[model samples]
Target: MRERVGVYPGTFDPVTNGHLDVIQRAARLLDRLAVGVAINAGKGPVFPLEERVELVRAETAPIAAATGCAISVVPFEGLLVTFAREQGAEMIVRGLRAVSDFDYEYQMAGMNHRLDPGVETVFLTASETNQFISSRFVKEIARLGGDISSFVPQLTLERTLARVRDQAGE
Candidate 1:
C-alpha cells in the first residue's frame, strides 16, 4: 500500500496552538506530514525564514516525537502544488476557521488540483478554542498593545508581540 503522506503549507510566522492542533490531527491520518513554510517575497514577513522555521520545528517536535510520524520542515518557494508533488505528498492539509476562509481555501484547492491531478486536499475545522485565532488578528492586537494570551501559546504570544513591537518601532 502507498503511504498516505500529507503536506501542510503555510507562512507560519510563528506556529500557534491552532496550527499545532491541525498538524497533530493530520499526522494521525497520514504516515508523514511535511510542514511547508512558504516564502513569498511580495509579502514581507515579520520574522525571517530561519526564525519562522525554527519556531515551527520547536513547537511541533513533541508531537512528531510522540507520534513517530515523519515530519519535515522545508521551505516552499514556488508553487505549493509543485512542492507537494516534489515531496510525494498525496494530500494537502488545510485548516478552515470561517466561511470566508472556506471560500478562499476552496478556490486554492481547485487551483492546486488543476496543477497536480494526483494530489487531493483535506480540510480540517479549527477547534472551537481556536476559531478566533489568525496571524493577522494576532499581529494587529499586539501592535495595539492588546493581550492575546488566550488565543495563542504562551511562547508564541511573547515572540509575536516582540516581532510586532520591533516592526512597529515601538
Candidate 2:
C-alpha cells in the first residue's frame, strides 16, 4: 500500500496549543506527517526557525507515538505547495480557528490545487478550548505579564515568556 503523507506547515512562532491540537488530530489520519516549520521572517518570529523546528519536534513526539504515525519536523521556505511536493505529501493539513480563517484558507487551497492537482488541502477545526489561542496573542499576553498558561504547552510557555523578557530587556 502506498503510504499517505501529509504536511502541516506553519510559522509556529511559539507553538500554541491550538497548533498542537490540529497536528495531533491530523497525525491520526495519515501514515506519515511532516510538520513544516516555515521560515517566514516577514512574520517576525520570536523563536527563530531552528528553535521553532526543535520545539515542534519536541511537542509532536508524544502525538506521533500516540497515533503511531511517523512525524518528522522539517524547515521549509518559499511556496508551501512546493514544500508539500518536496515532502511527498499527498495533502496539506491546515487548522481553522474561526469563520474568518475560512476565506483565506479557501483561497489558498484553490491556489495550491491549481499549482499541484495531485495534492489536496485538508482543514482541521481547532478544539473549542483552544479555538481562541494564537501564537501572536500568546506572545502579547506574555510580553505584558498576562497569563498565557492555557494557550500553549509548558515548555513553549516558558520559552515564550523568556523570549519576551529578553526582548523587553527585563
Best by lDDT: 2
Q: Each candidate's TM vs. the true structure? A: 0.93, 0.98
lDDT of 2 at 34: 94
**Per-residue C-alpha lDDT of model 1 across residues 1-170, encoded as one tens digit per residue:** 98989999998866777888899888888889999998875667777898889888887888898888888888889988889989999899999988889989999999999998899999999988887788777777778989888766777777888888788885
Lowest-lDDT window of 10 residues in candidate 2? 154-163
lDDT assessment of candidate 1: 0.86
Instruction: Give the alpha carbon lDDT tens digit for every residue of 1-170 in model 2.
Output: 99999999999999989999999999889999999999989999999899999999999999999999999999998999999999999899999999999999999999999999999999999989988988889888898899999889998888888899899995
Best by TM-score: 2
lDDT, residue 32, candidate 1: 92
Candidate 2 residue runs with Cα over 4 Å from true position:
none
Model 2 pairs whose backbones collide: none
